[model samples]
Target: MNEPGYAIRAEQLTKRFGDFIAVNEITFDVKQGEIYGFLGANGAGKTTAIRMLIGLLSPSSGIATVAGFDVYKETENIKRNIGYMSQRFSLYEDLTVKENIRFYGGVYGLSSSEIRDKTDFLLKKLELEHARNMLISSLPLGWKQKLAFSIAVIHDPKIVFLDEPTGGVDPITRRQFWNLIYEASSKGVTVFVTTHYMDESEYCDRVSIMVDGRIAALDTPRGLKRIFHASSMDEVFLKLARPEKVGDI
Candidate 1:
């Protein structure tokens, strides 16, 4: 279940490899049930920040809390309370849909009966009932994306972190996948997503645009557009990303 207030909190989060700082001192918060988007160009430290938040990578410095547990000291607790789906699908290509779900559920400590029940519900909800027996490799790209997302949260995590969840899917399929995200948020699941697509960023309730490992902008889509004096998210991003400076636009 979600806590009463913030779902995620970060303070001066920093990550470094030798002299290369992958993520600088960045801070942000994600409210319970909110759709929070992390937007940036490739290698802008978006993935690095997410890895720290999800407990997969240790930060060189700074502090963070996910689902009320400290990221550095309470990583296991954070893992238990959150789900993650990376850009790489991460499903076993040879496994059938049902098998993949069962494996992931088991990893999350779900009982067989619970996995079965939840799998049935998810398959129906995703309209994948007919494909439940199909091998994951045989499924279409869009179906696999949706299935991966569903499996990521099958254990009923309070928060779900998606890193470029709809990367290469067609526009229509991407819209459908977003509908699923909306469904999850409506059910009180806080979604933390990262994407390069400015259009997708607009769908977020709030967005943080990262540049050179720092948050260059953070606000609602309308707020961003208003602040940047732009007509759309693309224009807003361009203005922030100009070589001159964030304020030059």
Candidate 2:
């Protein structure tokens, strides 16, 4: 479990390339064991902000920390304590399910014995025992997503960054995937996720909506709905994303 207070913290976080600012000065705190939804449309800077938080991209200014490690100086340390699952379903299509698990474990510096043990555990936990030796390409999209997420947290990282982890899956699979997320949160893992799905945003403990590289709204789902005088998160998003359409709501 993380210490009391925030598992992730940012202070006036900003990122820029030349004269164009990709991520404006945004600040927020994500508590340990909480599911935080980072919502924004394409080109709204959600990805840039996530890259900075995970230490994939350096910020032009401001300070941030993940799992208690500084983004600038302790990027390696940060990577070791956090897991990542991208929307692209980052799994090798030719590798068998078991092989992929072992490969990721090795990448995280796990011993051979540890990799073997994790492979056994994940297969059972994710109910993939029947397909353990099957090539990833043969699995359905839902299975691939579950396997990708399982591999990401194989080492039990303190925090996990999920970049649109449920893009194209069906409703049933999405619900099942969220159950997995809830299970991880129950075990004290901070889940930082980014998505354009409005219903997905409602599942978060709190959400932040970005507009043109700036956080226009940051609050709990209920709080945001109440503040925006809307009926749902979708309405809140529409209101914030298109302020001129507030009257339409």
Full-model lDDT, candidate 1: 0.92
| Residues 134-163, model 1: lDDT tens digits | 999999999999999999989889999999
Backbone clash count, each prediction separately: 0, 0
Q: Alpha-carbon error at 244 in model 1, in Å?
A: 2.6
The true-versus-predicted C-alpha distance at residue 243 of model 1, in Å, is 4.4
- The CA lDDT at 166 in model 2 is 95
- Number of the top TM-score candidate: 2
**Candidate 2 Cα RMSD (Å):** 1.7
Give one digit per residue, the lDDT tens place, for model 2 in 60-126.
9998889888999999999999999987779999999999998999999999999999998889998
TM-score of each: 0.95, 0.96
Off by over 4 Å in 2: 1-4
Q: What TM-score would candidate 2 get against the native?
A: 0.96
